[model samples]
Target: MQNLILLLITAGSSSLCACTIQPQAEPVPSRHVSTIVIRQPRGEPGDFIICNDGRVLVFPVAHPKTCS
Candidate 1:
């Protein structure tokens, strides 16, 4: 009987060990709201966006070698 009780306690405590404790995030302050969406093409990885006012954003154009 005592071994059964100890087994139950061990199982309960081990289950509690699986619980996760996540750190809370700090509050962030923001003023302006802006959004940009970049769509991934079917196969290529060099795609980007140059949208105007959150709409009709065209894909990235060929950049000049020294357009820094």
Candidate 2:
């Protein structure tokens, strides 16, 4: 009876050791690119607006003007 109890205890303890604890890996950082839109001043006249992506956009003149 004592040997049976010891065997049961050893089997239960060995099963608990099967699980391993490991530190979680950190996530890799990612790079994001954003586009910004720029509008010309209400009364100012300009040909184009410079963009962050190295492109110049044509500035459309507002019709009938806009209230400040």
Candidate 3:
């Protein structure tokens, strides 16, 4: 029937439109070097761990001057 053909055409066009419409992701700012002074009396250089947000890190130190 003509109605059945029209229904099929409408359904196909809706599915094609749904496939073309995609959700976009929000952009995140690029990470840059952010420094924090070692407060502890004994800590070493090059000993660092990154935070979850890709910013704010903790650097452990074993000696006052030499950081490794």
C-alpha RMSD by candidate, in order: 15.1, 14.6, 12.0
**What's the TM-score of every candidate structure?**
0.29, 0.29, 0.32
Model number with the top lDDT: 3
The whole-model lDDT of each prediction reads 0.60, 0.66, 0.67
**Residue 60 in model 3: lDDT:** 43
lDDT of 3 at 33: 75
Give the per-residue lDDT digits (tens) of candidate 2, residues 8-39: 99998877675444455789876887889997
Candidate 3 on 1-68: residue-level lDDT in tens? 99999999999999989878977677998798798896755535545555556664454455323222
In candidate 1, stretches whose alpha carbon ends up further than 4 angstroms from where it belongs are 21-68
Error of 3 at 51 (Å): 67
Question: Which residue pairs of candidate 3 clash?
Answer: 43-61, 43-62, 44-61, 44-62, 44-67, 45-67, 45-68
